[model samples]
Target: MTLPAFELVQPRSLRDAIDALAAAPGMEPIAGGTSLLVDLRGARVKAETLLDLGRIDELRGITIDSHELVIGAMATIADVLKNPAVAEHAPLLVEACRLFASPLVRNRATIGGNLAYASPAADAAPPLLALDAVVELRSVRGRRQVALAEFFKGVRKTARKPDELLVGIHIPRAVPGTLSAYRKLGLRKADSISVASVATRVVVDMAGRCQAARIALGAVAPVPLRVAKAEAALTRHGLTVEAAADAAKLAAEATSPIDDVRGTAAYRRRVTETLVKRALLELVEKGGDGR
Candidate 1:
């Protein structure tokens, strides 16, 4: 199908790209173009200009800075899947990336686009939310950082101002004792949107007592969510069958699943609870990333 009339900007620098976005009357930035191409062809996202950001050197790949693991917005899912630092420091993300589309799409799909689009069933958001990730956003005027918890506003919605470009994703450095995992319920795994997704990250003391816990869920609410009630139940508890089961119940309470073509809200709710149990129990029984 022929695309509509659109001007293209190929900026050599991020500053030039920002200016281009600010100046275009109806401009949108694109990387990979996987999602936007569909929207543009369907006439769902009307834009007279497309600011392509694929060449921006500053916005790509993975790095372990002194303070955190910095991931550029333009980094492809495949890049993430193969990066050793990401696998070592943030395996939860690696796990999620493993389940995102296929090798063909992963080679093109970017973290920035996925989080910016903010689909409720997106595999990345829950794990990032559980990791306490931060996103760096830039506008013509300045830059700001927002925690992932405050990022997603609703289904297909986010806190981003229209002019802001999501520049990078920031994840805390993984240290010893930090344990994390990601779980997704897809119809048959390949090319399936999540029926339910959950991510759990916990730090256990040498004696096996939980020192910290974070539980985030997706495909059950309008946005990926942290189950505060579930986290509370785990932080001081032991890593055991009973503790995992109890946290799963709290996670179920925090969800507000809706009936959809994928499954009934009730079904989604139950699966979320089960997924949480599996994640936590798997951690207890098997230890860290099966790697």
Candidate 2:
């Protein structure tokens, strides 16, 4: 279906983009237009004006500063895959990008757009959540940072105000002896939304005990979630097979999945258990390189 008619405003700068959004009540920001355009065409969302942020140079880059990887909001999935900084600091994010969609979609889909869309099945959300990422939001009033965990309010909803623009995503550099992995279960091998996805990050001490653990899951809840109960299970005990199995059970119990076309709630819970256990076991075996 063709998209509904809407006025398109191409902003040349970040300030102009913010001003445009403030000026129009129903003005929505568009970066890659990958998800927004689809929503518009399907009549899922309506906007009287679209504030195109593609021309805004300030919101586009991948760099590291002060022990954090700063990814500009406009940075595409392909950009993240190619950036050495992202690979070094957040390799699991790269894994998500590789499974994001087809190359065509990856090239045009901005990381900001993906998060802004706030799809529960969004491939980027799980890894970013596990990485303890933070989003920088800017407006005429000022800038504020929100933790990724708190950013998603629900499915297709977020904490972003109408007048605010997501400017960048900041991820703390993975510390030494940190091991991470990601797995996505989808109907098709490529270009499909996740049925259920898991991203795990484990910090191991010299004695091979889990110092910290983050287990983030997607498509099994209203928002991508970090299973605190499961993390606690791992952190409480050494990274043993028994501990991993117990954590997996706890993770499955924590999910509030729904029966969707991709999967049933029961099926999702089962997959979550399997994936979480596998990820923890893999990390335990490979150990950490501090990368």
Candidate 3:
């Protein structure tokens, strides 16, 4: 199906793009156009004009500064995976991108589009949320930043204002003595929305106790959820198989899952527990933990 007739504009600067978003009614920004194109085909999304963000050089690169990992809005999954800095400092981002759609889709999907679309199953959100990322939004009014926890409202919904464009994302550096990992369960190896997913960043004491932990989940609720209760249960606790299992159960209980085609709610709940258990155990093993 063809998208309905629409005007297309390529803005060269941030100011020009902001003016366009503010002025154009029923206008949509296009980075890779992966998800938007699908919605357009189904008539689920309609736009009078397409604002092409591809040419905005300001929104097209990756940089790691002392303050945060700064990623432009237009950086593709492919670009993210190829950046050595990402591999070295933020492997969870690379892990999520590795499991995204196919190579074809990955090459064309932008980080900004993925976050703004706010799919419950989007792989990036869980990791970014775990990392305490902040999303920067720009409009004619001004710019503001929202933490990942506050940005997502519900399934397919976000705090993004109608006239705002996502300018970039900032991920605070993982603190010293922190270990992080991500895991996703789908119906198949590829081409499936996440049935369940988990991202964890854990800090351990020199004595191997969990000092702090962040557990962010996806695909099991209206919005990506943080298993705060589960994380709390693990923090300051001794590393043990029993401890990990119990934490997983708490994490599973935290999800308000609903029945879906990929799996039943019961199955997803069970998977969530199993995934969290593994993630926790992996952290211990990598840190040379006896547990």
Lowest-sum lDDT 10-residue window in model 1: 282-291
TM-score of 2: 0.97
Instruction: Give a tens-digit lDDT track for model 2, residues 1-291.
Output: 678999999989998888877877478888898888998999988888888889988899888987899999999999999999999999999999999988999998999989988989888999999999999999888999999999999988999998999999999988988889888999999999899999999889887778999999999999999999999988887677888899999999999999989989999999999999998888877773321
Candidate 3 residue spans exceeding 4 A from truth: 288-291
| TM-score of each model, paired residue for residue | 0.93, 0.97, 0.94
Candidates arranged by lDDT, highest first: 2, 1, 3
In the predicted model 2, the residue pairs found to clash are 177-290
lDDT by residue for model 3 (1-291), tens: 667788899999989999988887457888899888898888888787899998898998899988788888899989999998777667778888899888999888999989988888888889888878899999999999999899999887899988999989898766667788788998889866899999988777677767778889999888987888888877746555667788899999989888988899999999999999998788767772532
What clash pairs does model 1 have? none
What tens-digit string does per-residue lDDT give for candidate 1 at 1-291?
988888888887789888877776356788878888887899888887788889898899689987799999999999999899899889999999999878888999899888987888878889898888999999797999999999999977888887788999999988677888778898886887899999999877666677788999988999989999899888756677788899999999889999998899999989988999999987777553222
Candidate 2: list runs displaced more than 4 Å: 288-291
lDDT of 2 at 69: 94
> Model 1 off-target regions past 4 Å?
287-291
TM-score, cand. 1: 0.93
